[model samples]
Target chain A: AQSVTQPDIHITVSEGASLELRCNYSYGATPYLFWYVQSPGQGLQLLLKYFSGDTLVQGIKGFEAEFKRSQSSFNLRKPSVHWSDAAEYFCAVGAYTDKLIFGTGTRLQVFP
Target chain B: EPEVTQTPSHQVTQMGQEVILRCVPISNHLYFYWYRQILGQKVEFLVSFYNNEISEKSEIFDDQFSVERPDGSNFTLKIRSTKLEDSAMYFCASSGGTGLSDTQYFGPGTRLTVL
Candidate 1:
């Protein structure tokens, strides 16, 4: 079975600071990767995805992720963080059945 | 813009009770799915619906669980006998393709609490 690992349980950054959330996946073949954000009591919102082509993928809300094959990583990054960016983010890998295998999640905290 | 919608945002049930979670996917989507997230845990895949049938389902979607598209717009998940472990947030998602590149749009999840 494939699994996703987000080593960071929580990360705090100042407003306007650059942010990066680490995600590592275990799979034998090339897998579809995605980043989704969730505010309190809200649904998962798609931020970005990587299916193929180009190691770098851009997504909504000023977010991007770089897929590193060697590291089995698809880390999400943002140039500047805002207070509203504080939320729980999940990293997931798409399975052959097209179902998603998700990581535990990384809670982001932004401070002024 | 079209969005997936789920009914009964919060549901509380007793053990051994039957609970049904309802969802209405985007009108044009070709694939529909259900995923669960336990508090303080990862989002777990439960089942997928396609072509009026179950295309795939995880081991967690076992004997006690079932899914149905009882109507053109309504997709539902029924738990025949709820257990304490069955309490979790259930999310319904829909995508426009059978391909991996399609992005799945998710609905506001139903928070199920079994006591």
Candidate 2:
């Protein structure tokens, strides 16, 4: 079964600081990965996705993720996180089942 | 410029009652999907629809749940008899499959509460 693991449950970071959120996946074939963000009462906002080519992919809201095949990791990063970036982030895998397996998510707290 | 849209931002229903959540996907999108999130839990895929028929459904999408594209634009999810565990936020998404890969777009979601 394909699964996703988000190592952090909660992370606090100072404003304008670089951030990295860890994600690891278990999949047999070439994977399709995604990162999504959600505010307190809002639906998911797609950060970016990796299907094929270019290990580094850019997403909305100044977010980027690198897909590493060896480590089975697709980690999300941002050079500077704004206060508005305080939200729950989720990493998901798209499987042949036509369903998405999502991580428990990491709640980010941007401090000023 | 284009995004999925869901109706009735929030819904409250008693147990054993039926509830229908509605959504309108982006124009010209071929694949449609429904996913649910139980409060702070991970988002779980419920079902996917294409060509007016169901392409795939997860175990969570049991007989109690059904989907429909009754008209040309509306996609609806109906829960025949709601259970207490059914309380969650339901999200609608759509993607255009030109070939093999496509990015799915999501709506704001519908908050359903079963009291």
Compare the candidates by TM-score and give the number of the best one. 2
- Which has the greatest DockQ? 1
lDDT of 1 at B46: 97
Model 1 DockQ class: medium
| Candidate 2 residue pairs in backbone clash | none
lDDT of 2 by residue, A1-112 (tens): 7789999999999999999999999977777899999999999999999889899999989999999999999999999999999999999988433667789999999999
Candidate 1 positional error at B97, Å: 1.7
- How does model 1 score on DockQ? 0.69
DockQ values of all predictions: 0.69, 0.62
Task: Judge candidate 2 at residue A67 and give its lDDT.
Answer: 96
Across B24-110, the per-residue lDDT of candidate 1 in tens digits comes to 999988889999999988899999999899999999999999999998899999999999999999999988885657878899999
lDDT per residue as tens, model 2, B33-95: 999999989999999999989999999999999999998889999999999999999999988
TM-score of each: 0.96, 0.96
lDDT of 1 by residue, A6-91 (tens): 99999999999999999999986779899999998899999999999999999999999999999999999999999999999999
